[model samples]
Target: MQEATADTFIVRIGAVSAGTIAEDGEYPGLWGAWDQDGQFMGRHASREGVAAFLASCFIVDEQDWS
Candidate 1:
């Protein structure tokens, strides 16, 4: 876990960037989520939720490449 900027939280799996979580300006209190490719995932109530979502997405994507 690292701060992408002052406002954004970055989650990495090993050395790869998994996704990012930031305050959802439109939803207030919720966190906006985006995949590594910058695709919108959804909004989460907490950073932990966002991280779990990104990790699960990465796992599924990795399996698709196999």
Candidate 2:
């Protein structure tokens, strides 16, 4: 396991659920949601544009998981 810094940012986007994008200590990329059983549930893009899109749509107070 690894640790995250305050500068690290994670972006999530979806209709029903959200997933992580560019988590701390992990390689820069997109991620998707998983079921309670840890099975993948959906898809998300990891492109630079996708990351920017996620950031643009993000709302801190509504989605803050910190």
Candidate 3:
């Protein structure tokens, strides 16, 4: 992950862009999520909330892999 600005970040998965998380411009203290293609995902009350959302979207489940 890289800090794009004071209120925005570029999330990555080993150099590949996963998505972005940024603060809501209209609502202070809220954050928004977007895909790498720049599609608006959703908004959250906290940065951690948005981050977890991005993780759930990008991270693949590997429990079946022995």
Instruction: Assess every candidate by TM-score.
Output: 0.86, 0.25, 0.75
lDDT of 3 at 44: 95
Model 1 gets an lDDT of 0.85
Off by over 4 Å in 2: 1-19, 22-46, 59-66
Comparing candidate 1 with candidate 3, which one achieves the higher TM-score? 1
Least accurate 10 contiguous residues by lDDT in model 2: 1-10
Clashing pairs in 1: none
Alpha carbon deviation, residue 19, candidate 2 (Å)? 5.9
* Candidate 1 residue 36 C-alpha distance from true site, Å: 1.1
lDDT of 1 at 18: 83
Q: Write the per-residue lDDT of candidate 3 for residues 3-39, one digit (tens) a residue.
A: 9988789877777777899988888888999988888
Clashing pairs in 2: none
lDDT of each: 0.85, 0.38, 0.81
Candidate 3 displacement at residue 10 in angstroms: 1.0
Question: Which residue runs does candidate 3 get wrong by more than 4 Å?
Answer: 60-66
